[model samples]
Target chain A: MTEEARRSPERAKRLPRAVREKQILDAAVQVFSRHGYHSASMDEVSEVAGVSKPMIYSYLGAKEDLFIHCIRREANRLLAAVEAGIKPDLAPDMQLWHGLRSFYAFVAEYRESWTVLHRQAMSVGGPFADEVNAMRERAIELVAALVVSAGARRGLAEQAESSGEGMAAALVGAAESLADWWLDHSDVPDGVLASWLMNLVWLGFNDLVEGAVWKPAE
Target chain B: MTEEARRSPERAKRLPRAVREKQILDAAVQVFSRHGYHSASMDEVSEVAGVSKPMIYSYLGAKEDLFIHCIRREANRLLAAVEAGIKPDLAPDMQLWHGLRSFYAFVAEYRESWTVLHRQAMSVGGPFADEVNAMRERAIELVAALVVSAGARRGLAEQAESSGEGMAAALVGAAESLADWWLDHSDVPDGVLASWLMNLVWLGFNDLVEGAVWKPAE
Candidate 1:
């Protein structure tokens, strides 16, 4: 092939928009995951993707825009993982078991995505933190919905919802917190951590379903 | 008496070491809490304390030294608040309750102090994070002790101890995450958040005492 033919503009015309966007986001997540949002540079992202800076700008708009896209993409993946794994037809306990196990597996499979979504994004100073926080709230609400459904099966939904929103918050908070602890204790399988949470909160929540409430000693 | 004569050398003399140290720490907490550790300035801290830069240097060593001192001071204050509120005489549920309540209260009263210890110190990246993380670990272990106490009382101490460490880490993480959530929802009293935690985890924990574990559905 001639040198002129080898240097054709066909290279630029070859890649589809969707494929290029993914390439940019993958590189952006890699860099942002390492140094956090404030410290990550557009220059490094382009170099890592082997694309020019202008290509990144045209495809992803700007740094913050790129970050939100990453967050939205990662959040959808995580939320969907939990959703797909939940077995709605089963008993509440079984459903929660599936959901918790799915969450642990997702974290184990996608450590960088979770880190970028949870730690790195939340620490920054702007709309991205809000975006991350909203996703977190959605996760908590998912737990709350599960708790409410479980409680409703036994006529206990009102209490769990009224008082259970807070319970949902605490339960989800504990799960997220335990997931982080599980990271350092990688010696322990994520399945065990998921089961531990199931035994801790989910079991206790079910007990509350049967007219059981822990009251202070008289 | 002449004003100049009354003032004399006594007025120009340096403050006692103990007093100077406290003043510097108070000022450092204020500055660190306001601007975060990186943006905080020694000059501002000295000025806030009504001392000179030289005195700050002689007393606190360097910026990192001053930050560690601030974290140590504030962490101790928070730990003491938690420890003082806990009673080994109580059941594990109540013991955990009191500890959570005390923690929330400390975060509420010493808002800046806790923020400096939890947020800013962790961000600056060094021994400061380690120092703060150690104090936080102690707080978690303390909660683990309460959980273990119940298991011990039930003659399941061995079982509890084996898993109590992870539970402690999860419990602490839950409390830390909720404490952060409560910061934005200040209208909710500390007792409320503490009680919510008690209902969520402590109540469930009490069930663990009774041999009720939530198992996966068949």
Candidate 2:
């Protein structure tokens, strides 16, 4: 083994308990991604984290609570990544493009985070699904706001905002869904994937606002 | 009870085995949707179908094979529904618009079918994911062809097939993902969901072909 790997105990004791909790949660996401929520057990998570089950329970709550915490933490991390990527000096379309790239980049680097957010969260019943859905709605609303203001600034009216919500839903869904698809298929970079959303949504929304409709042309 | 309930033995004998098999398969899908694939048992399926367990085994294979059968059957039914709804006489854009509407309508009415095709299929490992993804790719390929040809017809000379394929992945993912979102909040009609997609994608794709890009506008 390498020098760092050969001295395992020296590394394990270096971090505070909070840092250790983060370590455990990171391992938990990986396990959850593989087996899903129902099949993933506390025992496996503890084993993967190189910590005892008691130590895990002491830091995070029981299984469901721990999962919720994971979702909350990861969702914020993802959103923050997107938010940080955008620059206010850029135009609305450019801002959206930057955000899309950020999302794809985040998911690409953190595949397990996307998996936990997408696949595992849905299988869960009751409050967990509701929780994830709420977070999703928040994301949609954020995107919808971006679309509305941008459209308005370009002379598109207030009425566009009503339909903007639904449009945002589709745009967000396409981005998240395509991100998952890109995971399985290689050769598509995060920038290109993000660019697809930009060219498709931003450009198209621009066209409709400018009144260049896609008609029968008969 | 209905007259059919009173004439159970008489009706059972008269019904063909092919008809009976279909009834059994439908019942299996319902049961599978409520509980996941692994959690669902043959006994539950038989009980739901009002048939014996042996009959189910005889008609379908073991649990895994039976699930795969359900995926294939449901996938075919869904694809056919979409195909039936598209009219070639309409403009290419309009053809796509109708197809999206039809897709949402199918999901709304045959929610169980969409659920089976989407959620349940992905839950199982290996073969089921591979098969469903292939079927999904075929659907995307059709959309990709539409996008690529539309781009070419406008003298753009851009081969959007590959990128369209990626967008298709995003679009399908969005449709399926939004459908899941819609299930919790049913106030949004199938038509609204479909049109949301039409606006988001159709409008965006239209812009690219026209070369009216959504830039900073400096």
Per lDDT, the best of the predicted structures is: 1
Standalone chain B TM-score for every prediction? 0.91, 0.88
lDDT of 1 at A130: 66
Off by over 4 Å in 1: A1-5, A8-13, A30-54, A61-69, A87-95, A119-131, A147-162, A209-211, A215-218, B1-14, B27-58, B61-68, B88-91, B119-131, B145-162
Provide the TM-score for each candidate, comma-separated.
0.79, 0.77
TM-score of 2: 0.77
Encode model 2's per-residue lDDT on B169-189: one tens digit a residue. 877767766776676567878
**Best candidate, TM-score:** 1
Q: Rate the local accuracy (lDDT) of all candidates.
A: 0.79, 0.77
**In angstroms, how far off is B136's CA in candidate 2?**
2.5
Off by over 4 Å in 2: A1-14, A27-72, A86-91, A119-134, A150-158, A211-218, B1-12, B28-50, B61-68, B87-91, B119-134, B155-158, B184-189, B215-218
Error of 1 at B177 (Å): 2.1
